[model samples]
Target: MDGTSSPGLARSLFLLLVVLLSSSVAFIEPCDLLYDQAVQAFYKGDYGGVVRSMEGALHSYAQVRRSKVGCRLRCEDQHPFDDDDAAAAAVAELRFFDVVLRRSACMNGCIEDKLGTQSMHRVSEDVVQDFHRRIPYNYLQLAYQKLKQPDKAAAAAHTYFQANPEHVEMGQNLEQYKDLQGVQEDHFVDREARPHQHSFSAGVRLYDQGDYEGAIVLFEEALEEYYKADVECRALCQGPQRFEGHNHLLYRYSLHELISVFRCTSLGFLENLVKRERCLSRKRWGCPSQTASEASGMDMFGRPFHLHGRLCREAGGFVVKAAWYLRRHKQELELLLIGSATMGVEFSEGQYWSSTGGREDSNRIPSGTDGWMEYVPISEKKNVSVMSPPQLREGGPLVYDSVRLVQNSIALNGTQRVLLDAVISEEECSDLKHLAHTVTMAGDGYRGKMSPHTPNERFEGATVLKTLQYGYEGRVPLRSARLFYDVSERARRIIESYFLLNSTLHFSYTHLVCRTAITGQQDHRNDLSHPIHADNCLLDPEANECWKEPPAYTYRDYSALLYLNGDFEGGEFIFTEMDAKTVTASVKPKCGRMVGFSSGGENPHGVKAVTGGQRCAVALWFTLNPLFRELERLQADEVIQALDSQAQSQWDHGLHINPKDEL
Candidate 1:
């Protein structure tokens, strides 16, 4: 009887041990475990203990980052499953993504599934993990500050800053730490700031100081670190990277954006040198090429109520391929396109416009039309026609015997659109770059101190407006400001002549743009200097449609990016399909090299991130319509015209001015 009872008791004891282990497995958040101890030490006012626990917490985060569990959690955290069932579906498909995404999500889910019912709902594990890696230095920064150790405090602040360059407060804190009695730049070192970031930052600093060899040595080290980091980053699933999600069905993205205030797109309405460009509305808006009559009463998805007056104001800005200009008639406005007949455009509800019935005057709208209507005047109207592509050898208006316009296999088959070489000289490129750096550093860029890119980037773009503003102030050379026009004008001539538009092109916009990488920002980087986009329309990747609406510079007929300095890593100009991936063409930037293309969804393009050194370029946007002329360019032309009478030139005119001439 005793031997039988002993066997049963042993089995019960084994079962009891299994229950305890299972419960222990439910608490798998090691970062949380270490963090709880730090929190307890903080509450107890044991500052040393808090530091020690946080050190362990940071190690836990690093270990988790090296593990598949953290990588999978981060990949999914970016675009969280919008529903519980979707989350379940995602969890079930981990194996598929493990192969597709190249990260083993299956093991991560397996490790995380043990915490299913016992999971903490207060904060996401991935978010906490990120904080665990970066924010401990921030806490340590404050702790060391409280401990009266300025050197260690500065080091902590610097570490946090390296991890997050865009954090306004930490940048300020780092500035303060640097001011501390004996804290030098050397004190701003971190052991955990991604080995690549340290090497890259040092390289960039050296490069900026003209120490190219030293910078190169460091850059090579950075590259080696980059490969290691790439593997580690994959394991962490960190950054604002786009990844495959189970919510592919929720990819209903419609960018009803215009430049500012309001957005209006023309649908199949392009007049001969007198009509605004038409864009097919994107998703749920029906046919892209529907006539105004067919598109009547359609919803302008993002048009605000304040845009009632600004709709046509913004619509009038768009210039199609034909180089048409719009004008206003007395009370009645007419928008005539080459493909359409004399039809009456009636605006009923102030939402959509439709054309129907007959009107004798093809160029004028019918009497008493409502809402916003654009018309062309009789004097400005011309017999301009978009005949065909220009045969350059046949002697077009512009000749380039010395220059080479290489037709790249970019979008639109690349015959008309080209990569222009030798249009602008090397000296001209240098001056414009100098002007860009000078004017942009004067706090006159589009975003003023902040770049118009993802976090951890520094963007400096000086528009024709700012360049002229600085030139007038004598901060920039007059010749540099004029060169911006001269170079862009050369590009315009190429577009007008090559595209064979009988009418000349006009400057819609001109910008001298620069992008630089800030160290430690890679953790949040999307890896694009400029996200893939169309100059005149918003690209809808999921629907494969180009939404031409507000915020997009739809008035732009052609885009020309003239490359300046090229001693940088990355920053390649890539032409993509409407999908924004699937590279069709890539143009490496160099002095005097210009990429000319149609500014539509058909020519979606973007600049890759400038990983090292400074990248400078002149972004030139052209429009056919004189009405939508770049006002800033006109202002610059005025300033140049005052100084040099020969500068009284249109961006589309034949050359009478020297681009390399400096004031």
Candidate 2:
């Protein structure tokens, strides 16, 4: 009876807290409300209150994960994946981006639904960090200990210890639990852990028992949950930083307006290059760096960055906290790689209402974007009016005021150099789209071969060579082929100028590709049309690293996509972290909008599933090495020139050449 009443008490306390802090953080997660209840209960000697509140808090996580409440990303307004040989072979694959966005949107929507306000999606650092790090276990173990439930207390302690094995205090507590009565070895593990552990362990057992179907189901759960857990960690990493004295500093200032303004005390600078190397966030990506004295200004890529020298607060102090959750994901990967059932299960959020997330106050730029969220929106990036080449090319498109491609995000010396522009005219876009339909062949990207991804849909592509060949054979319009070649060359010149290369960028590969959703394959579709990947490296999913050699187009240094039309839906291009789990930035497809970026692991990207009409684009790649330039491009141009000459000569001769007589 007491156990049930505690949840009611928590809901009451949660309502009261909301009324009190409503004016503060407009958005608060659902689990956070229960978590707040647990914190209140702990302070008032209500140990049972803590257990009830935390349990409720943990279960409430299902709200963000479940699809019933519009938590999953909606592709309902569009068509579904095509039911092809590839789509029929397997179930739809959910990727890192789909899970991350779905979960983030769910959390946001859940908060908004509960509070009836729009403030929740921007979760405070305390809430994001606390929940994922299993901080509730910290309170739960102590609450259980005081409640005299040694078995439960030992389990909670073990869970927290696994997340933070370096903490001496937790280590000592575990040592004491060994001698505690009623605390068995089986009791020293998280029983209500994330769903994957049980499913995976059960699958291993079933596999050994030769229950193949049951084993398959369990393995699927493990795989899906592994995808979900990785998102939970990456989301937490995006929130604000609260170091040792953040709250105290808040108290030191009394003015309400000044309340939002506070700086981090210079807590020593970190010179650890080795540590940063292990981190997904690094400054050495192709972005140009500036020293402290340098003023904030725009670069050629059009990214605005301000250098703070030694004056800024270091994230290392607070950032390392995220590594704990990242390690959990790594362990899950290890669990899958080894396919072992013996792995341990574990996992577990609040705040003084820090003002770091607010715009016009103390804040940090979001990773993978240029000035977004206090953000620099893609719509506002029209600064570079010209090619701005480092050196003049004698025959380059001299003035491109109306045809420039703008960099979507700042480089910050990072791998991202994504540029967005609408250089093609509406007529040209229509022409290219028409040409794609004219020359498209069976199969999609693989060209009549089996899709490496799903069997549901098709990927169709025509290279410049194929387009030219088809046009000469009188199968497609000759003008459309010229249009395709012209657009690709324009993309190549834009890429060459934007990166400010000392030498010219040669065309390595240019393709016109289209992806379509099969009518009726739309149900249960949440996967990307093109899975997240780096252009120049082979992604080893188990290792979480992109190997930069061999079969990959190692010579290709840059990539660009020239969208012919935006008549479709749900096909946005996004730049992501190496894991392809967290989206750093996203660009919607539009007529004539070409997004270009480096073709390496420094800039991982993918296409969202096109749920509406067919999505078509001209994909282009450039290489610094001239030897590897598209030799076939030269042949295609030569053939087109020959056709032009033959037509002109026939017209000049005033005679048809069907008799096989030339001259």
Candidate 3:
């Protein structure tokens, strides 16, 4: 009985142990076991294990595929699949990617059954057609096969021919298919893989295909070849001007066409002349045509002239020529001035004819806190200096070649007058005499030639009006733009000293000249040889103290007209003012002497028309500046602050500023 009882206990114990192990196994899951085992084998250099584990995962996946379908799958924390179904498809697709990625022919049919009727190539094609455009040739070849396009398959195989030229075997196989037309196309494509050539013929082909722009590029290449030859053959004695001229002309024309083609380019095109320098070489390297260079030195209407700078106490008393580089493309330069700059408040308040603070109907607008347009009434005290006549010698007309600013002055009113006198010197006098001769020669030569606008009678375009009218007044429009020069240092020094003496005085300044002959009959309707206008009218009446209040009055600033030589006949400084009705003031031409007064509508002044020979004079004007550069600096600061705040906000949001931001 005891032995039988012990046997029953043992059976029960054994059964209990089996039940416990079975429960543990059920909880662990066969898939989990396979996963762990496969991971371990994979790391131990058992690629077969990796395949087996991956297969086990798929097998487990298949068992409960319905439950896992359309569920998001994560790698780290990124969701590669947009949908659960996409996740499953990606898993299956990855296996095919892996096989083709390795370029393994060994695994050819391993996935055939699993892939079923959906070919691996079809899967690859779908991926590439959607988002994976950078597909491999091996995968693409397989895709062509599944598409049953033998010609495309052969074309794909031929892609590898460069590295593996022995692909003739594959090509022959593809030829067995009846798409002979496709095969022929592939052959033709292969032939075009030769080295390319750059020439006129090549460019002509491109041009014939409606590619004029491309043709231009080819022409440029041919031009470059010529340039290289010219460089190689450059002689030491010969100047490089010829070659440079050719190059500049070609480049200029090409750039012009390109600008028209795109219909857009930066201000760089206009500023090219400023940045480029003339270089000498047999090759037309940094070159320009003689005609173009000569043209640049002339005024807008193709008349020779020189740029000058001026300044005055009254408004419009000063007018400086725009920078030489900037003068050519005034429209573009104006855009820069208008778009970004904050103009003085007074400018917007009045029309072109009225001064900023003038009590005219056109300038009665009220001042605003912000905006480009605003009206600032001029204070009575501001016009105190305008009434006094500048003590300047009304000497013979003198001309100068160059001028530049140096140190400013800080003196009383009398001292300021003395400072202006200190600017003149013997050297300046001699320069005037030489300039007079040069002008005479140039005028003689120009007059001899058939004058383009000979009978300057009609009011044609602005060009015609300015050339004929202004020319008759003995005033030459500017030619090349003027820059800073040490020769005019004395004059600039005097102006600077005046400014220092009166910190309240702020204005722009420039120096100019009237050259050679004058054609009075052709300049204006009146028989008068010279016409003059006051310069003071540009100022606001309320702001200027020179003008009388209540009924309103006009003010005249300082203008210094110095005679360089006394070799001419009818050149005289004429001042026209409506003091006692209309008054005409005239001064004879004399070397070393200068006539000083106001200009424009404020004091209408002109040169008595040149009756004979040549006339040379150094003309300078000064104008007022209300707010000055200080205001400009303040505005710049405000713009910077706004930009900073915007930058901080972008930083907090973890985003970078756009490249296009106004950096």
Candidate 4:
């Protein structure tokens, strides 16, 4: 009987302990757990997760506050509260509301920073309320404006101004919104079908199809349409408002696209010239019929010419006597011959003579030349039907010779720096620009000053835009990524061979950056130039500077910049030797040129203000420590495979790869 009683006592004691533990665990409310999750998500840069978790917390808290039963079950406060239960509940509600508002503000900022205004609108609409509105309305106003909903933006701005009547900036913003609302309405009503827009779109399609000549014509048409639009706007609109009414933004964008198309077309022609020259050199086509000319000329209309030239191939130089027959239209034929004769022989080593109103020395040619001499036609438009004397041609190879890599030492004190010319091919340079432009179009233009909260004073008057990085998470565009990786690898090899840098050192990242000049506006004044600084530094926000003290580990040991285009003004890379108190060297941005140097105290450099056009470049940073080795190893194969897959997909889709809708 005593043993049975002991067993029952033990069972009851164990059951009591279990119930106590369960009650303690139940005291931890769902809202608290949700808030913790939201905080974690915010730190991880997962704005969407932050929004979801915060919304859940808000809903849970609201449910607990609305129902007494729910409050009793969930709100098991660990701290003791006196008889003033109503005040405690009020305090708790206010605290929870405060947390939600702060989280929502952060989420709104994230959306605005990354996804632009449309996303900001979606996120703002969810959080903004009449009772709890303060900062959210400001974001709502801006978001609506970007969405082209002027009326809604105006309404948001008005509400914000009414809430904070004494706020000077808010009042100013309200007035601006009101003014823009009228302009926006007028634009919507007055805007008509623009011919240029149609032409531009058609041209882009033709370009995608590789019909460059057709694309050029359409682009020209688009430019003419823009001019017509401007003229019409000037005639119709009042003084100072003529330019304001027309689509100037579209006009500027069209110009940019036209430039890109022209570049592509020019590159295509150059490539074809190289290919034809290569075939000729290889004797792919049987030795030129011993005919006067190696290759015959065709007119713009694709009509073959009765043109011939004597081939005088030489080791160092060659001289050819090119002759053409004039038909009924002698004037046109002579003019065409004069213009096109030099096109093939312009790159020759020695000067050649043309028979268009030029005296030929008797010593250079025999006394009685031949039937070719009798064919020389006079400048008059009459039809003589005579064949002209052969034009003397002396020039180097028809195609561009291989670029020789040349390195020059920069005269900077205390640093070993060099500029490498012909480091990359023209094709690679063009490819990089196209990739940068694509990425810029896809993302929010370009980012400046890393953080929005950071003061712009340090940036001077420059605006910099950066594309997705490579050799990390495969964020770079597929084609551009391959080009960048190739360039980076070449740079690494150059550093190893020329500078004698350790082969073990590896590049951490490669990215494209475009820098443009800025005009002073408001309190901010920025020059296109970047301030002198070393890449390896500890960011010290207290002093508003990059502290240049050496760290224990080697990071950013070297920097490499590959200039993509040289068609810009004023921006120059300058290296300052602090010890010598002199500018060591100033390098102009040249296409396919690469510059590399130590990114330490010995080499302090800055970009001079770009006064006119924008400058684009590829920046590569390397480090001795293998901190990013595993990341690069993991991403290398994935990136290559993804790029191959993308290329195959593009091929399958045929010409005219549609612009990505995600960006």
Q: How high is the CA lDDT of each candidate model?
A: 0.54, 0.57, 0.34, 0.44
lDDT tens readout by residue for model 4, 1-663? 111122123323333432343332222235545655665666676655665665565554433322322112122221223344446888866666665455445434432332244221221111223213333345445555655767656555554443333333444555565456254432211011256545654555666676755655555455444434433332222111111122323332233233232222112212222222222323422334433232444354323333232221310011011111112123433443443353321111112222211113321221111111111122221222124622221111212234334444534333556676777788888877776655543112112233122222122111011222332234555456566656666776665455564346576555566655443421333543565666775333344434332221126777778788999767788876543235678889898777777665557677766665667887777776664442332244334555578679989888655679536
- Distance from true location, Cα of 567 in model 3, Å: 1.2
By lDDT, the better pick of 1 and 4 is 1
The per-residue C-alpha lDDT of model 2 at residue 489 equals 83
Candidate 4's C-alpha runs over 4 A off are 1-407, 410-414, 441-481, 518-528, 538-554, 579-581, 629-637, 641-663
Once fitted onto the true fold, the runs of candidate 3 whose alpha carbons sit more than 4 angstroms away are 1-427, 430-484, 487-489, 495-501, 504-511, 518-526, 538-557, 579-585, 599-602, 626-663
Clashing pairs counted in every model: 12, 28, 49, 11
| All candidates: TM-score | 0.40, 0.38, 0.25, 0.33
Of candidate 3, the 10-residue stretch with the lowest lDDT total is 311-320
Over 1-663, each residue of candidate 2 has an lDDT whose tens digit, in order, gives 111122123223333433343323333357777887898899998999999998777766544433222212122112234435355343334443444455566556544554445443334444655776678888998999999998888888777655544333455676777777777767766544555545555555666676655654555454345334433333333332332222322222222112111111001111111132122122322222332112234243223244232222122211222223233434544544343223221111112122221122122211111110122222222222123622322223413567763453463124436555667889999988999998876564462443444554567888787787676667788888888988888788777776666788888888898887777776778888889988887765566666653436677888889898888768888888877888887888888888877787778888888777888889988888876787557556556556678789989888655666653
lDDT of 3 by residue, 517-581 (tens): 43554334332334443455432333331232211112223445556666876666655443412
Highest-scoring model, lDDT? 2
lDDT of 1 by residue, 1-663 (tens): 111122223223433433344434434346666766776677687778777887777765554434333334334444343344445776747645544444334434544554442234233433464574466776677767767888877776666654444344455676666556877767766646555556655655665676755654555455444434433333333332221121221121111011110112221121311111133121112324533323332132211222112332222222211121111111112222211122221122122223321123333232212111122222222222123533332123445665675654433354335776777788887788778767765223442336656565687777775666566567778667767767777777776776667677888877787888777665545569888988887688998877553335667887788888788877888887778888878888888787777787768888888777788888888888776886556555545554564344553365555776644
RMSD of 2: 27.9
* Model 4 poorest ten-residue lDDT run: 315-324
Model 1 spans > 4 angstroms off: 1-398, 409-416, 441-449, 522-526, 645-663
Candidate 2 error regions (>4 Å): 1-399, 411-416, 444-447, 540-544, 644-663
Lowest summed lDDT over 10 consecutive residues: which window, candidate 2?
262-271
As a TM-score, model 2 comes out at: 0.38
